[model samples]
Target chain A: MRTVEFETIAEAVADAAIDAGRVLPEDVLAALAAAHDRETAPIAKEILERVIENARIAREHQMPLCQDCGLAVCFVRIGSEVRVAGGGIADAINEGVRRGYERGYLRKSVLNDPLKRMNTDDNTPAVIHFDIVGADELTIGYMAKGGGCENMSRTAMLTPADGRDGVIEFVVKTVRKAGGNPCPPIIVGVGIGGTLERAALLAKRTLLRRLDEHNDDADLAALEAEILDRVNALGIGPQGMGGNTTALGVHVEAFPCHIASLPVAVNIECHSHRTRRIVL
Target chain B: MTDTHILTTPLTDEHVAELRAGDRVLLSGVVYTARDAAHRRMIECLERDEPLPIPIDGQVIYYVGPTPAPPGRVIGSAGPTTSYRMDPYTQRLLALGLKATIGKGRRSQQVVEAMKRHRAVYLAAIGGAAALIASSIKECKVLAYEDLGPEAVRRLVVENFPAIVANDIYGGSVYEETTECSD
Candidate 1:
């Protein structure tokens, strides 16, 4: 079994968090560029240009892309043959997040409790998801998810009879209702099937996929295209001022479910999509 | 597209009167910052007949909770937050003579109606353009509610801060006017 030091993990997580805050993923940048080229509305085009320029400024100056630097989220795949030495994985990740937010001058946006509403100050503990896989390598995927878009996420359990059309309609309706609050020119992540919580997790996991990547399943890829068309038809545009470019892309992930359950979840991601991945 | 207007605060009635939906505005001068927590406190103070920390008359409130400044910088990545969360408290502030609010996204219909009744306007900054927006902010000082951390009320001096008039006193709405796709 290979052993990874907790300090090593912490340092990596810290660097990843800082990088994710300042740099828009290259694929997301490409998608925004394509959207700018196609957007006809004058306001929409201008807004897209600003978004692009904002990304560049953040990177050049090594500053957080947005003021709401977002809550830390990590998805980890631990190899069955690997072990973390010095401390638990969760604690290490949280330590990294605290240092990253402080050292990078990123905003500490987390509240200690939902109801009491006191600032956590250091932006910990991160929301971490873990999976055990049959390998010798450990991989961590990180995202700095803003509150505005997370607030717009939704989950629904549809009957098997509802099928493909139902999924498309529900997603389109959700985007329509969201308008500009979640920051349009949004990326839509959809999770189909699985249990309620799993579907939600799956939806968020789909967001980590690069915008240009297609689903391995042919039918799923086709469904993603259809949903993309319907969502852009929304006219929510950039910041909902209205235009044809409401969404930069739509990504969908699916898994098998019990005969009676067909759960679906939608996780909306804003244009400032910041994500990073590391493997050891 | 309309001509871009260069506006300075505290805004006058004439300034509010001249704006229309879709007009690009470059706002300068002083503006106050407040977000969810601070708004709640302001409304609570109003209900108690207590004075607000910042004067409302003819002032603009920017709904932003900026990151703490790194050394040598006045601020860090200041940008507009989602505005709909403030809808519940906005009308009351408008009633108190708040001239305008700068934020991102759509305001509630009630808030828009309140803007019309109060002869005010709603301006939208490009969301997520925080780093660029920070360049426009010349200075920032905490005005009140320091315990609220980022949500505290702060005074900002800005120059050529870019925004678009999303709602106007005449009931014009940029969201409605620019929509071209079918339902």
Candidate 2:
């Protein structure tokens, strides 16, 4: 059994957060550039141009690509064979989040409560989701979810009679209703099946996948492509300015569910879509 | 475009009038920072007829809650938050003579109506581009609600701050006109 010091986790979390804060992940940037090329709406095209310019300015000046630095969320994949020593893993992760948010000049957006809405000041107590994946080598994925797109997310439980076409229609309508509110062209993550909460979790988790990749299931992958095509055909455009490139991509994830229910959740990601992963 | 207007911040009607939908601007002057919390407080203060924590007349309020600045820096990653969240309090500010606002996202119809009624303009800074905006800020000082943390009211001095006119005083909103499906 390998024992890792808590400080090691803390150090890794802090450094990773800082690095993620400074750079727009390569996949996100590439997706935006490609969107700019494919976008046909004049106004949407203009919005894309400004988005590209914003990235250039951010990188050149070493500034955050967008002002909403986002709430710190960490997904930890722990190895069952590895044990942590010196302190609690969760505490270490929080400490690292505090240190990195403060040091990197990323905004602390976490509020202590949903209704009262008090800023936590330090971006502490990161929203951490952990999974025990294997016997060796832990993987950590950190994502900063901004409020704009997060606010527009939706979940629904359709009867099994609704089928795949029903799911596609619901997703397209959700995107259309969201319009410019989520900061299009948006990346959509669709989670189907499982229990209601797990379906939402799967939707949020699917957001962590690479921008260009599709579902491993061939049928699901085709469904994802079809949904993407329909969403873009909405002509919501970049920044909802009106364009052919309404969606950057669609990703789907599925699991078996009770025969009575077909649950679906759509989590929209704004253009920035900041995320980073590290294996240690 | 070289014949640009160089206006001092806390923008006035004349400054706002000079701008049109889609016009590029390089604004320099003193702007104040506030977010959802501060906006709520400001509205509440007005309800009680209490003295405002910060003056609003002829002012350009930036919707931002910046990251803590590093040593010797004026501000950090100070970009606009989505503007619609503050929609409820906007008319109250406009009634008090607010001349301009800077943030991303489309404003509600009520906010747009208030902008026209009060002769105010809304500007859109690039969203998700905080670091780029910070480079334009030359000076920053806490003016009020320092305890509100990053949401505190800050008096900022900016130079060549880039923004596009999103809403003008003529009851026009670029977001509505530009969004193809809006019609």
Candidate 3:
């Protein structure tokens, strides 16, 4: 097995965190530009312009695009052929989060208690999700999820009879209910199948897919298109001020589940969908 | 562009009603900072008829929990947290003469009614724009709940603190008037 040093992982995580903080991913940028082109409302177009400008200024100045630096959430795909050296993986990740939040001047938003909430200062204790893969390469994906969009997410365990139409309706309803709160034009990530928790995870993972790409399943692709069209019809516009463009894209990822259960999860991503991937 | 309203530290119902949605102003004097935890405490104080740790009458509260400033700076990137989380306690606070609130997002129906009845206004600072928010704060000093960390209540001296009126005292809400995207 190839042994990778803890410091190496730490360094990569720290660097990736900083880079993710400064740069809004290219896909998000592209989506905003396209939305700007299609948006009819002059005010909505102006808002989109400012969003694009915010991303540009954030990149050029090496400052976070939004003040809510976001919770440090990492998805690591560990290789079976590789072993970690030095310290515990959790500690390394925490250290990396500390360094990244400090170095990048990202806001430290983690709080200790939900009820009697207290800020943790360093933005440590990243919500790390790991999967062991057969490949020799390790992949790390980071998404700086803001509170607005994160709060708007929803999940439901639908009856088997609900099926495809049910999933589409639920997702559209979630987005419609979210309205201007999630900061549109937004990205809707849908996860169908698996158990409840697995469905939620799949929904979040679907966010990592590129905006322009469609699901491999033709039926799913058609559903996504229909939902996207209907969502734009809402006229929530930019910042909910009124416009034709509500959602920038809709992405769906599915897995087979038990015969009785049809679980669905919707993860809403705001305009600043900050994410980046690294291989080590 | 600048209005000189001699409102008390924590503003009053009369003062709140004077403002409109989308008006920008420089807020001076005293205001407190509170988020989820502090909000609950303040409401609890009201529930028990106990005096609040700080005065709420005729004051404008900014709903923010800012990061600790780096050395010389008074405060770090200070932007508005989501406002709806405090919706539960809003009517109580407004009824007690808490004049205006500054935050982002829509409030509940009860809170809107409270604003109309008690004559309060909800102002919105741009969400997620922390650095820009920080630059507006001229001075800050912690007054209560030191252990709450960033969620502590503090006195802020702001010059031209930028905010747009969200819900006015007359029961006008940008959220109500603003068209929402459909799906």
Decreasing DockQ order of the candidates = 1, 2, 3
* Model 2: chain B TM-score relative to the native chain B: 0.92
Which model scores highest in DockQ? Answer: 1
* lDDT of model 2, residue B68: 75
- Clashes per candidate, residues 3 or more apart or on different chains: 0, 8, 10
Measured as a fraction from 0 to 1, the native contacts recovered by model 2 come to 0.45
Q: Which candidate would rank higher by lDDT, 1 or 2?
A: 1
Answer with 2 or 3, whichever has the higher TM-score: 2
User: By lDDT, who's the top model here?
Assistant: 1
> How does candidate 2 score on lDDT?
0.81
Per-residue CA lDDT of model 1 for A1-280, tens digit only, reads: 9999999999999999899999998898999999999999898899999999999999999989999999888899998999999999999999999999999999999999999999989999899999999978799989999999999888999999999888898888788878888888999999999899999999999999999998999999999999999988878899998889889889999999989988999999999998999786
lDDT of 3 at B42: 81
The ten-residue window of minimal lDDT in model 1 chain A covers: A169-178
Query: First chain of model 2: TM-score?
Result: 0.96
- Candidate 3 segments exceeding 4 Å error: A40-50, A113-118, B1-18, B22-31, B47-53, B177-183
Ten contiguous residues minimizing lDDT sum, candidate 2 chain B: B174-183
Off by over 4 Å in 2: A40-46, A56-62, B1-8, B177-183
Pairs of colliding residues, candidate 1: none
Predicted complexes: DockQ each: 0.62, 0.43, 0.28
How do all models score by TM-score? Answer: 0.98, 0.92, 0.88
